[model samples]
Target: METQIAGSIARMDGSTSQDAIFKDVLAYKEVLAHIMKTCVPEYKDCTIPQIIGYIEPNPQVGQVGLHPDETNPPKIQGMSTESTTTTEERVVYDVRFSAVAPGEDGKIGLIINIEAQSKYHPGYPLVKRAIYYCGRMLSAQYGSVFTQSHYGEIQKVYSIWICTRPPKERENTITSYTLQERHLVGHVTEPVRNYDLMNVTMICLGKPEGKHYGGLLRMLEVLFTGRYAAKEVIQILEDEYEFAHAHTMERTVSEMCNLSQGIFEEGMEKGMEKGIAQGIERGMEKGIAQGIEKGIAQGIERGMEKGIAQGIERGTNRERLQNIRSLMETTGWPAEQVMTAMKIPAADQPKYLKLLSLPQ
Candidate 1:
């Protein structure tokens, strides 16, 4: 039960709602253009208006398909702000779209994917996942962007990751991994356009006062960190960056602030609950030991062990039930959802459900 509550608290701390809100803000054309102008080399010198024009009408957010079917790929259309491969191994991209890049001869198309990552180290190396996403984006372009034997027409792909919480050493850093040609033996040159098809950019954000806190990093920090109130953020966006969309930005910032506050309050409540539970458990253990000694003195030693075990079990069950009820009440979630969020086992759910249904 303690472990369950801790897990619930952790999930709430890094909740999907926060991620969704981040995605919502990032999906805006104005925000995306700012990011590309600051972080992407292709749009580094372009004006925000030009960059926004290059971006397609709508970027897909939380859509299916890292690998849509070659015969019938998902159509890139509409203005909704929100992909997967196979049915079993499908991957939904946080935000994916196509954009036009200025080239020497003509405009070139580029596929761009933007991800809002909450954790810097989520078990696996995030760079590998970014690379994999780039690969999938390139491969999924086969039937859509270019047909067989027309590999030259394949558009370049970029997977940009915005990590909200990175390790201290990697904080406020922007690293790019792209296909670069190295002369192994002789001075042979190849066109960059032919081979520079995949790129992964990792943008790790840290404290706003960090060394690298300027331009894109600072803008993202202000947006995601929830350090400033919505009005403060809006003022920064307007005065510092001259962002035009005040109302939209304000709404998004407000949503993020609200969610962050909720998570913080929930975490504090859970921490207090955990501290109280630990203290109660310690006291119960001490009392049980004293009772065992008294039982031995009273010549009831034969039943002491069984009685102690039952008492401990009952105490644990009561605590677990109380935790469940408290969570359900606080979250306004149903019993099933609360139990699922806490990661309670399916086998124990029926028993808990029965207990929960009984009168107090």
Candidate 2:
């Protein structure tokens, strides 16, 4: 019965890309709690409020508490729990948590970084990319741009990677890596040192089913596929009472179930006239993703399709710049690749390439 339900969700997600917005639901507490259960396992009992307070010493004031010198807000929002379909990094951190505060107001917590990667890069590998992100996180903690903070104030950073695609030489679907020291001289035990202050976890969605990760795979199904995995999501949550009560999963189901209303409203607001049908038709004719960019949203929002392109050709250069930026940010493609992929004009390519080199 549960398996049948999950199949329905997969089919639904196939049509609507709701799974692409896992970052939105992440703002909820229940979702964060279950994520913590999968990644750290240590804070399995920590509630939503505890997770918030632990991440920021003063959640009311929005203090990250990541560093003692960190009084002012960091430029990057310091805490981005959502996922954006942008051209930048796909770093989702419940997959990577850095701190954990234990029981009884013990104040044991971590400064965490979670990155979610839907696509795989064989050239760098997920592990290597994860290491780079973790290293950057570690270095960023050396001292704030403001006052100097001691290294002692640096909280443990956890870099967790959840990959929708499996990488080469993947040992297990879920593998945890910790620092270990070995002494071979006197046949003595290799002492596991405490000096290493960071940890990494890699979860591969394509891995074969094992003991514990089955539940995680199901959770991922919901996170990545939404309504397509709705049935299994319910079954999985039923098995875990806490997860069921959290309401994050339930909320996602509700949103997916109600999405038709939103689409209809959007079409109506866009006038749903000949333009609406034409825009949708163009989008389907091109590719839903590519069409969504130039078709309905842009077509309705701007009311010009070829005109936008002509403006570029005439060197007026407004929509062209906006489209390039939108594509770059949304797709995270290099300027050249984006150019080729989008079939940008040869003359326009040089201008676009130059734009990429300039700082955003």
Candidate 3:
């Protein structure tokens, strides 16, 4: 869309939360739906109409209804499957939203939760948080009093977190977590149907090792990072008519740049290598130069002030000592006279008399 996404917020701080930008851009179902389909590969078959249901999560808000049970086995990427499952609570999400889409069969629906995290969360690691969110979303499906009362009615939950900074060890940008049915040699367990109830996907927008990325990944790269309006991306959006490509993509990207100026600059510098705009580079350089210039000038000013004070003290002391010696040799003045003329302390008269060879 040629229409510009304009907002009252023009600049963003490094520590600024991306929740506002996220809410504004993803508010469009077309954009949000496109992201859901792109980020979660398993849901590629599900149509946008089948996927998007609620925008943001609120405990105060009631669940619309139970989703269709169409959860396909999750494909874990960049990690191995766990032989066991755990019952633990997920950390509260910064941004929580839901979606509904049918599975491969086109009859069963999946419950999706989209999460956006930008800041560095140390109290809870990203992986742990991802698992927690998945568990919470899965458990939240069957509301005791509100939505689906039946145990069978529980739908598959997709917990997707778009983390700005991922774990150091994980090199890949996308990480998925899934449950697998594994049999142990020693442990006694009964054979039961293993349902992929919850799937956790962490989309890490780190600099990819490869040069090429799919349309979905490209959109996310631009959206999450501050490299405003990559020409190639805009061309792709214009070429491919996805939910986000329908004009909202351009507006959303523009709005993000116009409103949050610096969100794109932090996290990583690889964005610069990806052909960021020259103006942004110039702005950053300008800021750095200005800071350096100001510091140098202040340092010089303080040094000059100290130097002048020291010089004056040294000159005054030298003149007083020379005058004391001259008075003793020229007029053979008394100690009191020399001390008074030089404005020297009374205790220094004896030292001055001894220096001039006068009687102490």
Ranking by TM-score: 1, 3, 2
- After the best TM-score superposition of candidate 3, give how far the Cα of residue 271 lies from its true spot, in angstroms: 14
Q: Write down the lDDT of every candidate, Cα atoms only.
A: 0.77, 0.55, 0.56
Error in Å for residue 158 of model 2: 0.7
lDDT of 2 by residue, 1-360 (tens): 121112223334455454433433443345555556677755667664465445444433543445432333211133644333346555445333334567344554466676666555756667777776676666655544213645555555677766665555542367777665665566655322234556788876643444344566656644553334455555655565345333324545545535524544665678768687998898787786776676777667566767777766767455666777788899998777777877878887998677666786
Residue 56, candidate 2: Cα error in Å is: 4.1
lDDT of 1 by residue, 1-360 (tens): 121112111134555466667666666667788878866778877898788778874445664335332112212332222245564356777778788878876888888888999788999999999998888888787788789899998899888999987899999999999999999999999999999999899999988668878888888888887778889888888888778755545656777777766765787799999999999999999999998889777767647877999999999889989999999889999998998998889999998999999999
Off by over 4 Å in 1: 1-16, 57-82, 86-88, 264-360
TM-scores, each model vs. reference: 0.63, 0.47, 0.50
Q: Which stretches of candidate 3 lie over 4 Å from their true place?
A: 1-17, 38-42, 46-98, 104-106, 119-121, 144-149, 167-172, 185-194, 208-212, 230-235, 240-245, 249-251, 265-360
Sliding window of 10 residues with minimal summed lDDT for model 3: 70-79
TM-score of predicted structure 3? 0.50
What does candidate 3's lDDT look like per residue over 168-275, in tens digits?
553235667887666666665542313766778877665555444545556666566665554444565556634433443455555565444464454246566545
Better of 1 and 3 by TM-score: 1
Q: What is the lDDT of candidate 3?
A: 0.56
Clashing pairs for predicted structure model 3, backbone only:
1-247, 51-100, 68-109, 90-132, 226-264
Query: lDDT score of model 1?
Result: 0.77
Q: How high is the lDDT of residue 157 in model 3? A: 64
